[model samples]
Target: MVLDLITIGWRYTMDFRRPTTTAPAQTPEEAYRQLRSLADESALRNLGALYSMAVDDHDIDTVVAMFAEDGSFTRAGHTVQGHTALRDFYIGMMDRYVTTLHIPNSHVITVDDDTATGILTGQAELSLNGTLMMAAYRYDDRYARQDGRWVFAARTLKFMYVVPIEQMPTSFGDSKRIRWPETPYAEADLPEALPTWDSYKC
Candidate 1:
């Protein structure tokens, strides 16, 4: 049945082979290398979840430690580099919220030697200045192995929408979906704004 499926152009989606172009490892050394690669990929993907937990917990130290010493983070046009800058950035940002719960939904990672890149999507429920708000967002990440552990080399954050939870129903249909309290309404940075999204239109 499996061979018949393959003959009909149905590739095995459950294959655990890495670098898909290559065949399965035959020698023990080659097997070890493949295992190491998978381990690195797992660690890199976990970085996103670890970051979300640290941020929601207001743990600046753990958050900054996830990045390389000279790593950087970019969000909403502002970029902060190095551990000191990253530490300060999170400190100020977390202070604006009374509490937050970040849910990391999905992550896709590509590994090349000791470096990697990933895209992560998630949502968050926030208590900002006592007002309940929700956000849908994505992170574009770059990672490097340093001292035998994966760390973020750089990360860029983009928001699909951020609105008061009560406004969720109407927010997506509105042009300006970023509805932060006391701030002017602003456009979301996803879907319609993505190049592929525009190309797919009729």
Candidate 2:
């Protein structure tokens, strides 16, 4: 009889606790906004994927067209601006590599009105002068909605590390400093500083 009374008392205490309140229903405008945001994110991701493929295929024209007319690509502290300059840069870069493949590790995009920003991290394999070279890179990209399409307004490349396949050590120790390559252009054309340390280094 005592045990039964204790069980009943516990049940009565729980009954007085309030149930969780559900979130309010989203309004029509809120629903539409969320849908639009999703679409924009999808388009931005597609843009990055296309870029990787185009570069690996040595399709310079297609790659250049993916950017805005006034778009710019900055790499290794040097900035290439305008369609003409970007085309030349890609052509020269492709010439240096007989074959290449870029494997995207991850990408994330944040949308703001007609503009968006994204970061892409990837590993690249290149055959240069009969030697295989591997590189890890990150691109900080800015996108603008032009003519209802997402196009790159600016893309900045940060090379985490690049080493000949045979030269890569089994482990990256400390990784507090990085060995940055010299720019292909004159010193005047490069940025003041370049980031070398890994962003997610433990």
Candidate 3:
């Protein structure tokens, strides 16, 4: 259900500024520190891609794999957790659509050693039996390093808008990689984390 509320959106003034993080070492000492930072950045970006690959492959298993064992996905007023909800949600969606495109852009990735956080802004368009619908929102994610791997621990999202098929609006694209846009942006692309995004295996 896409909202009819449309006004060129602006940055939300949140009482909370940035996520709290650990202090980086003052040591300009080793190349390893910089490498670790880069690696962490890479992992954060992968968080976004994992979501894309999960939906694109129609593999809820891959989707759930992106999360920690007790991790949860929250959107709108619904929350899905563990693995069962993960499976059920996607399986249920299959009844209505054959394919979906998850266009993620404006990603904000924050990293520190064994933990990182991300805010992913993007739109998703679903083509159900040839009918098209679009949705726009932000995914505020909390990730942790578990057993030497990065996984989503919590995901909070807020919908900015949606354009349903009933409205005859069609700007959604097909199944492919989504590129980030560059204007009138309510969202911002802070940094990219390729490691987190690349966790999903096709």
Q: Which candidate is the best by TM-score?
A: 1
* Model 3 CA lDDT for position 201: 55
lDDT per residue for candidate 1 within 2-93, as digits (tens), equals 11222422211122243345568999999987888779878876888888999998988999999999999988877899999998889988
Question: For each candidate, what is the lDDT?
Answer: 0.81, 0.70, 0.63
TM-score for all models, in order of appearance? 0.85, 0.74, 0.65
How many pairs of residues in model 1 come into backbone collision? 0
Error of 3 at 64 (Å): 1.2
Relative to the true structure, candidate 1 reaches a TM of 0.85
Task: Tell me the tens digit of each residue's lDDT in model 3 across 1-202.
Answer: 1222113222222223343344566677656776776787787787678778777778777877888888887754478887777667767866567678888887766666787766678887877556565667677777899987789887776655444555423323322112223223232121122222344553
Candidate 1, residue 153: Cα displacement in angstroms equals 0.8
Off by over 4 Å in 1: 1-23, 26-30
The order by descending lDDT is: 1, 2, 3
Q: In order, how many clashes per candidate?
A: 0, 0, 15
Model 2: per-residue Cα lDDT over 101-144, one tens digit each: 99887777777889977767888888877777777777778789
